[model samples]
Target: MQHLLQIFILYLFILKIFGDNVDENFPQYPETKQLYETYDFIIVGGGSAGCALANRLSEIENWNVLLIEAGGEENKRLMDIPGLALQNQHTYFDWCYMSEPFEEAGLSLINQSICVPRGKVLGGTSVLNHMVYHRGAPADYDRWENVFGNPGWSFDNVETYFKKLEDVAIDSPSLPDYFGKNGPLHVECAEYRSKLYPAYMAAAHEAGIKSELLLGPNQIGVECAWKTTKNGYRFSSNRAYLVPIRRRNLHLKLNSQVTKILFKGNVAIGVEFVCANQTYTIYSKKEVILSAGAINSPQLLMLSGIGPKQHLAELKIPLLKDLPVGQNLMDHVAILGLQFEINESPNVVEDKDMQLKEFLYNQTGPLSSYPAETIVFSHLSNGIPQYEDDFVTSTYEQQNHELYHFSSETWAEAFLPNNQSKGAFYIYPVLFKPKSRGSILLRDNNPFSHPRIFLNYLTHPDDISYLVMGIREILRISEQPSLQAFGTTLYKNKLRACKQYEFNSDDYWICQIRHLSTSLFHQSGTCKMGPKDNLDAVVDAELRVHGIEGLRVIDASIMPEILAGHINGPVIMIAEKGADIIKQFWANRKVG
Candidate 1:
């Protein structure tokens, strides 16, 4: 009886901290009672991009916009807490897609396949992501325009859209012109800073890398990462875009899965989806925008008979357009098992009940922040002679290498001790611009079934070598006097898989890199955007399918090349620009 009372009290405490107002008054699921047979625009997903698109497109008022999402409403109690970010993964809110077993990489994981967690809730992956808001380097967008022949996607052209969606709450003196004062998405640094944060920053400085804003003029240093949060809670796209516009002409349908796109000859007209155990067909008067993300967007296109001719024919589905619907898949891959032990204990939490009370009253405690403390972007080719291979030198010259520092207490709670005495953290070296590419293929004709994801990580020798060099750099940082002051030492537990090679040898690290490789969940470029002359181009520069009219893919799937940072910020910017492009296209037609 006492245990039950304790549980009840804990629930009340959580409710007190997060409050029951938003969840209690959240717009009803399937906001519209009667389904409209036709709408001016039909969005296929209510994800990060979809929510922004719904808000922007519905602003016209006359245009009735319908957003169909496969998942239900978000669980505010669990999702709003910044500290419970990873706890949301592999739950009912996640799609839980797994990559195919690799011969080289992910050998140590279950089934030798890595688990890819894409949010299945209303806010999509934004609800499950680490909330770090980072726009890629200016050169990244420049390459998108100059190298890929995208006319309006240069940094200069798209900079306004970046500002259009951001509302900066943190004080950044050097980034005065880069931030937007009034926007829906609130951007701020985490309130709770652990003792290890300063040590990590000092250690980076000791290694000759100074602290600078990651989104400022240059991204070649270290700094505290900014996040998409407001008042110690997550500010998801659903919260930022959909909730505020519930009274508008926007119609949202929850638990609706779009199975196929209806087309007339070469023009997209409507979509067939299932909701509440009944299938319905909805028509789009203007265009059918695909914001179903990299995985689902490609899967939906292929299931609707618009993919590779040979693959479609094999499935007995008639080919509509012979486009590369699911190729050139890119993601940021990071090496695991790189942990450092420190003598200094973690931030002391005296009493769990007191910590809860502090969070409930002041909203400043361990619960107010995610564990990712600082990020470092560096060029590895200049100093390391042994790793200065041709590919590494050229790629480093492009400035795409990124290293992340994370407090491992929250991440490795299952293995670590429960007390706050032991202190340890992780420094992950991420491969941002991978030369190796994978593909996505339909498992069968069923839209409900997950697509066969082939994330060919570390297939390229250059990628593995680059990661190895990054590990060496991390080792150097650990050896610095600033970190050594904390008695920082690399955890030297030898893995069974690499026992044959000498410990700390190059071969042992290479073997460990393959066995423990994992993804950062930034999958993109499945539906490559390029010029019409490019045969492998799935969508044109204007985001329209190459051969099909009145259809556009405006999500990460259309990225010609994945950027050098997290994709959430860029995805929102894409939707913002795409909405403007769409409004212009229709307005011009009316004028004509």
Candidate 2:
């Protein structure tokens, strides 16, 4: 125990030493800078992708890689608390950009976009997310490779990289074989459970469905959630990739915003950034990679004159690559949320003073970062058989021999609405793959102006149809025998009855959804990766912007399509693989 404590203290000390260097107030580089030679690689956006790239690229001692972030270093406090993420939104720590107005959202934004809050801190969204670590259905990656024509990006091919980035935080016996042990990001058990978790699972079972791992034998089942946490702490990319070795060689620049990429003809020579009273330019000798996530990535690209010709012409931004930069914005949009109640449990909102004390005192209890209780995955469509995605639950059976049983065909994952929740319980019915696609545009030339996020949500006729089907399923599960005992209530006076039960108005059910709908926040696909001839293709399989040199995009923006689950896990893996790709590219350059 003493040895373990020593190791833990050592880790914290090292992280603190590294993280201490980041400061918006850190003596700003003089306006008239002492010009250095050049770095071999320059990665923009110190979010998930950027951090991974920097960590991986720096592995080569000879390779001088510079990572430039527009945000501050990782805040250990925020890194360890899950529920506080929402509270940080719109603060100095967040970009706090609102979306362009929308009509479908009931004129919520007056046709103005809604608020978009992305982390401006070290870990990026990972620091701000609910921390449910789900690597979407395997089929999604297979489709991604097909769409982008990349041989190595297939689910099977990318599995190795995923394993390399993930460290399961659960006991060995409780995990599947595919999960790894010594990875960077720690994926642990549900941080805090809700009163409804067990009932939700039991109710699903009562309805003839089994509580099993969605990634198990079949993807049709229901199961609990697996989060991206470590030792009861939030595990963002900054935590895994940045905090350990930040002070070593990384020139992490916070409160520094990139204005434009300086190019000599087609080659990106350096970048211009505004620090305080003055602007500065940093040079990159070999490459400039963008990892500013889905929204900012495209916005930056367009600002640099690398988007569609007509769009740039209208915006008066010079056209560098007329290549659909912000065309295909996709997000995991879910109808608001459905709420349930629990009279007995001590809800997360009940006691904040105590919770804060718990965190600061013993480092145990609700203060731990594991926010969401559990997340269940299932394929609910037209009586479809469960599709075996990436995850599967393996178990041991009787007889000196252990028989493996899969638990994914029918499952339900529930989170007890702890302090992290807003008093009531919310079940967000996520539509993994929606036909609807949105667009991200430059609201104006001002880098601080919020981008126009025209999320013509439900624009695809089928998207709402699937949602209606999911609402119906949500209602069905609520009425299951097990849940009936819990006295769980629906939105209102039974709008649409279960198939075997009574019925109501279609409009009524739709109304319930609109009123309850909330953002699952899995936004992506703006700078889409696809085959060269594809009209909306922004980058190729190599993650290289189609028509540009010395520039590549390496964030969720490159996702050609949305996945079957949460995007955090996949994005982390993408960064890990991207690092390898960049490393190999440079290595071969030397070899050749």
Candidate 3:
């Protein structure tokens, strides 16, 4: 214990020194003079999509592009450490927005409001996310084309863009050729290499689940997730797509908060922003693309007079076009902190000594891997009456959807007040596609104040029902022979709120889920993209704003429907495809 304390102290000392020299290590942006200058393309919010767009658009030598970010560079040593990913929340790089108190959802939180963390730095959420690189199911995309009226967004059409952005680090020759071979982003299976992983896989198989580790578009089995990491560091969008490329055509403005979109009638002309405590306006001759993520994107739109008319009238803001800017807000809400005790902690060769050596020498170790390594994607209901067509259909619109099971190391320090050294693991049951839809609303017309967020999680009874069923499935998995070999058992932590009901009963689990349910940080679908005539649709199939010209929303906010996977990868793909669409439109204009 004393040795561990010394190591920790040394770690903090190293971090302090490293933090001081951040500006010298990370990429330097050009100094900003004044803002109102005109550029051919002005991409707001230097996030995952914004970074990709800036990189891709700047490829055209003649086109002048400006990328603006609300937060400064993420050069902190903490951002580079993969294990410290969760710690970045509510920190300097995070927007740290909180959701409005829930009426129908979030029954368990302190004030019934959940914390929403968004990236405010150069790479946006990509710099702060869990680094899980999932592309979602193919059927998810087909639904976008067939049901949502987006023709070019089918799995086949968008796969090329997915391939174009990734450089797969995993050497699985036996797997299908869906993965990208030559791309800028570095993706690899985390090097956790725990013995518990194999046992978990075996347990799933014993329970009639033939699981396969997949990195491509399909996610039908149990596997260790592929991550956006190179070596032991977090491979954020800025690192993968922006840093290496030296483009003189692109100008990046850091700490620039866009207040409103400057518009003339229906056409977007420029943006009014605050930088270094000074206000300025910048015009875009071509288009003003919004990639400010799910929360800020919609808030910015509404602030600029492009949202629901009724809401805008209350604030006395002149309405540009009456559109739902913050409606259809969707996220993957999960039941987190489900603990299970094993017979003994698995043999992790060189827990401290080897870890420090490996990280220093080659940047490889358990620290390199994300805390949650294994994930199981399975349909909640098979043919059981409880999981029947009606129950399943009532849960979500997807014909076939899977619940995400995250098996992770459950450090007792996070939960237990007494024994902080207890060995345990966690099983998080995540509702991928929920029936309940929420909204984002303006708190006031103030651009600096955070918009009121309504993440109506588990509003539908079926959402809670699915989660209850997932608990049952987890219990069954624990009972499997493979898991039984480790003497796996649920960690019986006393829940003061759920003590009235019998432990492990349906009612008790339901109570626990409601109180503990929080976001997976996969917030999306506020500015929905669909057919222009659809009243709820904010953007069209081409990602252009409905009833507006020279404007586009090319971020997670524009997702017509949230995919059944982590959003970072798909968000990048949207930017890649959106950039191509912009280039094509320019070429056609020249031809005309």
Candidate 4:
């Protein structure tokens, strides 16, 4: 009877937190009523890049900036809880995009298509994503400059922008030179460490992988993940970049979906959008920046008749400019079925009442951290020293891998059936750089319809081989003495699709890879940025759309190649640099 009562009370608490009336003391951002017919700058998609861009540009005082978002204000009561990060998916806060069916991957999923969750809220994906703060690798930016012909995007040139946006509060061996003491974004190590955390680190050490800070000089090894949080709460891009500067000259319009970019001949003039059953067209005096992420940004450009001539003509939309608007789609693919059973339960309070009380009072409990505790980066090839300076310098075609350590019950409940037993954890081996390329296309002429996304995962044989090798590397780590002492063993359930092959054979792993392939939510490279001579390039080094004036793309879509790690940090950095570039262009124009 006591147990039943406790469970009932806990359920009530859960309802209160997730309810619509939960009190979060933040200022209510009602839609700004003060209207402006024309602004100096208009930024579409108040996402990670858009928020930062609006904050920086509005500092000029004279430049009135407008930021339009397709979603409502962020639900702080639900989003502030870190452990509930994955719970945000499929909710109203998420775009909940469904990928087009592909036979090669996601065979086990419904209709052989995966669900891609992009945030539709004010902060964009930053509000919906697991708050892992990673800066990718320095070599990634070097390639953007040398190989892609983007002049000022080298590691040395962009590192300052990274420092300018960070406020590192973690205690680690990471040097001060690599981090900023005061910046808007607050980054810290996850405060709540499960018992499995130490065991996982020990297992990595026993397997010859050293423990090192990923944000430090080295890129390969195991470490506790740094998150974008503030005082045990999720610090989304909206909170970091927009909240503090709400009083500035920036006007934010929520729930406004942009349908097309309005152009006057070769120059972008404004945008046409719909809000509350009303269609409106607003103008921009200086520039219109598109930061609607990898998927929607390309869709908007193509809808505005700036895509391939044949594709635009098929839909009967007249062409204004001939360019490859939605090519080179890439994302980090991962095998989702890798699981292991361990003897020890996760280091979390089993009592739901105590868990809630601890979180409400002190903010030091399992609810304070994301389910993913640690991340590992490594090369699958042999004969390469792990600690060499060239660890991150390998070409994108090589076999580079990243593994995620997820809590036991969280992994099972999310991916497996309800009948599956608990006390199991997951080690998902992610292919950081995939050679397989995909594309985004318009389903119809209707701007309200969701765009068709095709992430052609594992189409390249090299990509499949890399994932196979990554699985082997993870199995070796499971055999280490540290994990063995905990009585860790692989979950022996055979996927129904792969039951024909021997369980542990290479062929079986490959089958599993195809059936349960998932994305790490790092989709990019759809609108390629490069030199003008490159036929595939859509934007120039300055992020200006080719042959178009007063228009630019300033988001992950402009990445010529996707970076090796999470993209949120890099997107913010890009916006910081982009803000400077825009300021410089106007300042020089005034002088001339």
> What C-alpha lDDT do the candidate models reach, one value each?
0.78, 0.64, 0.77, 0.80
lDDT for predicted candidate 3 compared with the true structure? 0.77
Evaluate model 2: give its lDDT.
0.64
Superposition error at 499 for model 3 (Å): 1.5
TM-score of each: 0.90, 0.82, 0.90, 0.91
Instruction: Provide the lDDT at 372 for model 2.
Output: 48
Supply the global lDDT for candidate 1.
0.78
- Candidate 3: tens digits of C-alpha lDDT, residues 254-372: 98899999999899999999977899889999999999999999999999999999999998889999998999999987775466666565537435656655655566666677656
Decreasing lDDT order of the candidates: 4, 1, 3, 2
TM-score of 3: 0.90
List ranges where model 1 is wrong by over 4 Å.
1-30, 348-354, 380-421
Model 2, range 1-592, lDDT digits (tens) per residue?
2333433564465456545432222122211123344777878898888888888888887777777778776665534455444455555667766555454542222222445668887778887776777666666777778755765788887888878987875454544677666887888765455455666677767766676564332456666667777655577887787666643444566667887887888888788878775788888888888998888888888888888788788878888777877877777665432545433443443465676555554455654644445455555443222221111111111110100011111001111223322233445566666776778888777776767777666667666666676666666777786656655554322222122333334655455444323355677999888778888788888888886788889999998877777788889889898888888887798899
Q: Candidate 4's error at 40, in angstroms?
A: 0.6
By TM-score, the best candidate is: 4
Q: Evaluate candidate 4 by giving its C-alpha RMSD to the native, one decimal.
A: 6.2
lDDT: which candidate is best?
4
Q: Report the C-alpha lDDT of model 1 over 236-310, residue by residue, as the tens digit.
A: 999888876664578888888999999999999999999888999999888899999999999999998889999
Better of 2 and 3 by lDDT: 3
